[model samples]
Target: MIQIGDRLPEQEFTFITEAGKTTATSAELFGGKKVVIFALPGAFTPTCSQAHLPGFVVLADQFRQKGIELFCLSVNDAFVMRAWQQAQNADAITMLADGDGAFSQALGLAKDTGAFGGLRAQRFALVAEDGVVTELQVEAPGKFEVSSAEAMLKRV
Candidate 1:
């Protein structure tokens, strides 16, 4: 897994924007910015929809007040990600689609949950300053803990 002070991999992420589907690299997204990135297993899963995403949405302004940009990433397609974002009313968090799990694999955070479905990213939250990680919080399998928005709020 990626560690503190490591630069985020320059991987592409697709996002369904108002204009349409768009692709951007990690550098384009994280370079020269202090960003809070949270990766979840899937877009519409119970824990992610009910708590993980919502916590960040609720705490969006607080993060912004600290000059941080918030991004929510999932190993789903842009269409699914867009739908989930709208369904959750998470306008505050930028939804990123790691459609092929390339980014997750690069970060060494990919897990094969084939029993449940397929390959997915582990639940994690990290603070990246200008593309370099300042802090990282990864949840245990089927658990939510330090990676939460409230926890990150305290840290930031």
Candidate 2:
């Protein structure tokens, strides 16, 4: 798994914006910025919808006050991610679609959930400054602890 001080791998993410579909690399997203990235298994899952995403939404401004750009990533496609964001009314967080799971696999956070789903990202959060990881919190399987927005708030 990626550790502190490690630069994030170069990968492209699909995002749906007002201009339609757009692509952004990891560097383009994290370069020269203090960014907080919270990644989850999939979009619209129970825990993700009820707690994980909502936590970030509630604490978005607090993270911004510390000059951090918050991004919520999932292994779903851009259309699903955009729809989920709209359903949640999460305007504060930037939704990132790792449609192919390439970024997650690159970070060694990819896992097979079998019957629950296919390949997906682990639940985790990381602080990146200028494209390098400053802090990383990866949750244990079926657990939610260190990766919450409230938890990140305490650290950052």
Candidate 3:
């Protein structure tokens, strides 16, 4: 699994913006930027929708005030991610689509859900500077805590 001091893997993520759909490389997003990135198993899931994503949405300004960018990633497609962002009123957070779970796999954070949802990202979050991980918080299965934005805020 990716850990502190490890650089994010090079990968492309699909993003839906006001302009339209676009692809951003990991370098483009994290290089020279202090970023707090969180990943969930899927979009519109219970904890993810009710608490995980909302916590970040509510704390986005604070993170930005601290010179950090916020990103929320999921194993869903770009369309689903876009919809979820809109539904959650999360304009302050950038939604990243790991459509095929490639990026999660690259980070060694991919979880095998079997028939439940196939391959998905484990619930986790990390703080990175200039593409290198500075802090990482991975949640225990079926539980939520350390990876939440509130928890991250205290650490970052």
Candidate 4:
């Protein structure tokens, strides 16, 4: 997996926001600002629903105060991403949809979620500034590790 000090994968992903939709590149999000981006296996799953997303949601304000943008990424479609954002009440975070798995693959963090029947994102977080990856946190499968938004905030 890619590590700290490595440049974050420069890839474009279409974010499926609840209000609308738009495409953003990695550079666009983190080029000149500090960014906290986490990847999830899939949206609406138990662990993700109750823990992963919620952690970020609750810490959004603190992150913003620290000049960080929080984002959550999944490999689902735009509609699913939007619905998940609404269902999870994640108003403070940007939900990005990696529908084609291209971005995740490019990051070398893509995973095969067998039961979901799809290539999905792993539980990972990257602290990026000025388009460079400053820190990286990767969790084991089925185990949420250093990628929690709170963890990232502490690192900052």
Candidate 5:
């Protein structure tokens, strides 16, 4: 698992917006910036739709006020991520698509869910400064707690 003081691995993430499809490398997103990144199993799922993503959306301003960029990541396609962003009215959050799960695997956060979903990212959140992790919060199987937006907000 990725730990505090470890730099984010080199990876590219997809971002779909009203303009068009674009790609952002890990370095481009985290380099020289204070960033908060939260990853969920999949997009549009119950827990993620109702609580996980919404929490971040609701507290985006607070994170911004503290000079931190907020990112919501998932192992779904760019199109789905874009739709979820719109559905959740999460305009303040930057949604990134880890379509291939490569990023999650690199961080040792990928999990197999059998029928629930093939390869998905475990629920996790981390605080990084200039590409190096400062803090990490990972939830246990079938649980949501430490990695939540409200919780991470207090920690950051």
Candidate 6:
């Protein structure tokens, strides 16, 4: 898990769209902005779909009011993430799929979801300003404790 004050990890990943797939790096997302990035184990899971992602979605306008951009990530492929986003009607959040688990691995936040058949991203929330992390919260697997959008919102 990353610690507060650490520089933001490289969060590059692919975001597949109907038009075609797109590639983005963390620098592009966080540079020149105060950003809130949250990660979940996978898209369409119990806690993630019902609670975690929706919490951020419902609060997106409030966060934006605070001058923060929102991003939600999962270890699934971008196509899956995109579909999930549409299902949930999440236009306020940028859905980034870390399909290779590269970003989570680089930040040491990947977890083994054996039954789920892959390494997944541990639940986490990070506050980054221009690509530097100012606050971080990494939750234990299956526990939706600290790394919540609301918790991070209070800190901000």
Best lDDT goes to which candidate?
3
Candidate 1 lDDT over residue span 1-156, tens digit each:
899989999988888878987888888999999999999999889999999999998889999999999999889999999999999888888898988999899899999998896989999999999999999999988899999999999887
- Candidate RMSDs in Å, in order, are 0.8, 0.8, 0.7, 1.6, 0.7, 1.5
Query: Whole-model lDDT for model 1 versus the true structure?
Result: 0.92
Task: Report the lDDT of model 2 for residue 46.
Answer: 93
Residue 11 accuracy (lDDT) in model 3: 93
Task: Compose the digit string of candidate 5's lDDT tens values, residues 1-156.
Answer: 999999999998888898898888999999999999999999999999999999999899999999999999899999999999999999899998999999999999999898979999999999999999999999999899999999999989
RMSD of 2: 0.8
Clashing pairs in model 1, backbone N/Cα/C closer than 3 A: none
Better of 2 and 6 by TM-score: 2
Model 3 TM-score is 0.98
Clash count of each predicted structure: 0, 0, 0, 0, 0, 0
Which residue runs of candidate 5 sit more than 4 Å off their true CA positions?
Answer: none
Residue 101 of candidate 6: its Cα lDDT?
91
Please state the error at residue 135 of candidate 4 in Å. Answer: 0.7
lDDT (Cα atoms) of all candidates against the true structure: 0.92, 0.92, 0.94, 0.84, 0.94, 0.85
Per-residue lDDT, model 2, residue 88, is 88
lDDT score for residue 128 of model 5: 99
Error of 3 at 17 (Å): 1.8
Lowest-scoring 10 consecutive residues by lDDT in candidate 1?
12-21
**Compared with the true structure, what per-residue lDDT tens digits does model 2 show for residues 1-156?**
899989999998888876799998888989999999999999999999999999999889999999999999899999999999988888788899988899899999999888878889999999999999999999999999999999999988
